[model samples]
Target: MATNPPSIFSDSRRKANRLRTLSLQAGISAPARFVLDDMVDDMAERLAFVRHEPEKVLVIGDYTGRMADEVLPHTASINAADLVGKHAIDLSRPFPVTGFDFVGVLGLLDTVNDLPGALIHLRQALAPGGMVIAMFAGSGSLPALRKAIYAAEPDRPAARMHPLVDTRAAAELLQRAGWKDPVVDSHDLTVRYRSMDRLIADLREQGLGNVLASPAPPLTRVGLDRARQAFMAEADEDGRVTETFSILTLSGRRSLAGT
Candidate 1:
């Protein structure tokens, strides 16, 4: 069994606040937002395909209420409701839910430290035959950033950005959580940015900044300069560098009547 940490939501909220502040300082603009918007659009399409129309739906890692709005109109006939209500849930703690027909977890599983336990909780909360759609960052995300970080400081590796749930691992997690017909797939989105600073800013604004359990020391002026150069080296003739995000999308169903 997984133990709930005290103040999980508070910790997450604090991190989000910090990222938002950094984003403002960095001056992120429309291009970054457009990439995220497209991702939400794809998620909405997939959720609409699930057979069950849950009266009450829980969207873990609902950040910014974007997915909720995208899904709401699609699920209107089913009268779906959002459990977290514009707030993120504490996955380390058991979610107090039952009889929900659907649960959509977007960009959450990759960052969770105790992913197996969290999946168990999600499985337990579903109604019979309830479906779960989970999306997470994959191993391939941030190739350019990773390379630049490594090249900038040979002694220090960039912090692991996310737990990086591969397809096989994700499928196993669903099975361990007692789900049936577990299905997993992945997609890639390449976001182009005018500059490295703008890319970092977008990450912060989207609440995807560094929150590693143990992050590297703050970048030194020299390191920052090198990193900036490395980023620019990767830029194309259009003066834009591409950040690749790999999203692993998984789905599964709880047994109609079983543990």
Candidate 2:
């Protein structure tokens, strides 16, 4: 039997703190608010296509705790969970509640060290024929930032970003985890920024910063100046550079055949 790989994340607690800090900052900024709203809106549209509305719904990474506001109208009950929030639930381990008719996981899978194991847990938590819809920052995101980081250090660039999953790989993992009727798709969202500092702040506020086990040390003053220059060199007519995020969404259902 093939054993699961060891965790690549810094720590569950560290991840939780990062999310908590972001959630607190989200209340004060609109850029931070867009990502969470985007996730919910997309989920809402997809849920509308289902033949029947889910009665018992569980929302993980409920960044703003307002997911219920949108879903509760159709669902009989909705529960929200996050690392540090009103509906607090740690996603690094098994979900605290199970047998839900549907699970909406927003922006949480991006940092999970054991995605296959997490999928298995989600499967076990669902009732027969129940569904799980998850979204995350996918592969090919933050190109400008990556390029600037590389340009900042010509000789030895350190690892700074998480290893994002591609659409094909995500689908394969869903199948490997035994999800029925698995589906995976991706869409791109681009935003223009005047400076790298603004982009970094937005990422931090959106809970999308680095969470690797051994993140690179803080950039030196020379590196920062070089990175900023590199980022600005890519600007357009309006003096703002465009950055793209490939958002990937996956939907899967538990088999109705057996538990």
The whole-model lDDT of each prediction reads: 0.67, 0.82
* Candidate 2 structure, TM-score to reference: 0.92
lDDT for model 2, on a 0 to 1 scale? 0.82
- Model 2 stretches with alpha carbons more than 4 Å out: 1-4, 12-23, 26-31, 85-87
Write one digit per residue (lDDT tens) for candidate 1, span 132-213.
8777677788888777777677786665354466788777877787778888888888888777787787676665666665
Poorest lDDT segment (10 consecutive residues) of candidate 1: 76-85
Pick the lDDT winner.
2
Backbone clashes (count) for model 2 = 0
What is the C-alpha local distance difference test score of candidate 1?
0.67
Compute each candidate's TM-score over C-alphas.
Answer: 0.81, 0.92
Candidate 2: worst-modelled 10 consecutive residues by lDDT: 12-21
lDDT of 2 by residue, 69-88 (tens): 75545536887776665666
Clashing pairs in 2: none
TM-score, candidate number 1: 0.81
